[model samples]
Target chain A: SQQGEEDPQALSIQEGENATMNCSYKTSINNLQWYRQNSGRGLVHLILIRSNEREKHSGRLRVTLDTSKKSSSLLITASRAADTASYFCATEHDTSGSRLTFGEGTQLTVNP
Target chain B: DAGITQSPRYKITETGRQVTLMCHQTWSHSYMFWYRQDLGHGLRLIYYSAAADITDKGEVPDGYVVSRSKTENFPLTLESATRSQTSVYFCASSETGNTIYFGEGSWLTVV
Candidate 1:
């Protein structure tokens, strides 16, 4: 079974707009990571926020984690046409040995 | 520099035939993983290895076999291919407690 489920299976927005995607997980985790996958390509690591950290930022990407809610959110500000891709949230369970369990993912389209 | 590479970028094989996908990394990362991506299923892990000679199953491990004889290489094999196994397969390597680096992926079709 997948450990996490991402909300808003798909999203579309105009360029320069903001896009947010949420993910909910079933169990506790040591850390959560976000990845981007362009069509017909493999996934690329975006960012990782440890369980102890509430938020993290990387350029236009912002990530927030709420341990109590067992959920996290990825925010992309000033989205561009190149930002169109599938975003996934992966959870690293404390018990697992660095094996990340991924969610279904959210497909985001940035219209130019 | 080749960070990670998967062989036979694309493959097409008949059902019931055995097929193998190769993955090689130059970083010598301690952990290696194999995942299959389907339309609605996202990326489901098939197997992972922490180091050479240590292998473990992931979320979707049925009909798949993985071996890590060397830290730089991990290969996934399908003993008997089935139509349902057609998908894009990816290989990744990572250091403990760090980000993972994925290969371009190998597209396989079981006809």
Candidate 2:
């Protein structure tokens, strides 16, 4: 079963606009990471927010984790056309072994 | 240097034939993973290995087999390829449990 579920199945916005995607999980997690996948390509790691941390940033990507609500969000500021891709959230549980459960993902299109 | 590489890049095989997808990483990451991407299913984990000689099944592990004989190599094999197994397969590796690096992916088509 999928531990994470991303909201807003798809989104379309202008190149300069911002795109925000949300993810919700069911159980406790050690960390939540976001990944971007271009069409017909593999996933690229974006940012990871640990359970103890509230927010983290990498370049124009911002990730926030709220353990209390079991939810996390990824925000891409001033989105570019190249940033158009599918984004997914993966949850790493605090278990003995490391196994990541991923969400369905959100497809974002940055229109020029 | 290739961080991680997967081959044959693209493959086409007949149903009931066995096919193996190979993944190799240069970082010697302790953990490796195999995932399949479908139209609506997103990325589903098929199998993962913590280290050499250790492997475990993931959510969609059925119909798939994996082995991590070495820290840098993890291979996924479909015992009997089926049309449902036709999808893009991605392999990922991580030094630890937190961050993962992925390969370019292998496109497999079972006819």
Candidate 3:
């Protein structure tokens, strides 16, 4: 119920399994981005999906956006133990100027 | 060195002290931002600047201050640090509508 809200606050799965994270927003956005953070370090950009785009993929990552629903999902295929990290979804809404609002994030654990 | 860098990577200060965190970027991107990361809250934007001398507040800008005197430097200051302000601060920059990059982070503690 916020600008960017991600669910499944914590997730654990076996290596090679698929990990999916979902995000929802309350307003129209220009673009939505996914970021990964390991431990407590800085965040690393993973991918970005524009409001007009419905699906995008990069290597093992896949992101889908549905503007009508104002929601997005990120899927990591064949997950690896090194993929363990917190994933966050951020949105740059139409009225947010040049900044983005981030959600609480999903802590993913890939057990090898 | 190349990307974004934050100074005073770790800091400890009293409750009422004024603390400033310095941010510098080498890419000279036009958009810069300050965000505070907490345990349950994730990353909350504090301040941002589109260009020099033009700054705006973000989602949580209560006690934080920001000024972009130059294109490469954006600094955030806590006028009066509070225990609630103790969190990891991150500085980021991007070319308008592009991928944003983040600094390592500044771990601050207020006692």
Highest-scoring model, lDDT: 1
Clashing pairs in 1: none
User: What is the per-residue lDDT of model 2 for residues A1-112, given as tens digits with 9 covering 90 to 100?
Assistant: 5479999999999999999999999999988999999988889998888888999999998899999999999999999999999999999986645678889999999999
Question: What is the TM-score of candidate 2?
Answer: 0.96
> How far is B95's C-alpha from truth in model 2 (Å)?
2.2
Q: Give TM per candidate.
A: 0.97, 0.96, 0.96
Q: In model 3 chain B, where is the ten-residue run with the lowest total lDDT? A: B38-47
Q: What TM-score does chain B of candidate 3 reach?
A: 0.97
| Structure candidate 2, residue pairs in collision | none
Models sorted by DockQ, best on top: 1, 2, 3
Residue A98 local lDDT, model 2: 67
B49-109 per-residue lDDT for model 2 (tens digits): 9899999988799899998888989999999999999999999998665688999999999
lDDT of each: 0.93, 0.90, 0.92
Tens digits of lDDT, candidate 3, A26-89: 9888999999999978999999999889999999999999999999999999999999999999
lDDT of 1 at B5: 98
Give the Cα error of residue B28 in candidate 2, in Å.
Answer: 0.7
lDDT preference between candidates 1 and 2, better one: 1
Stretch of 10 with least lDDT, candidate 1 chain A: A93-102
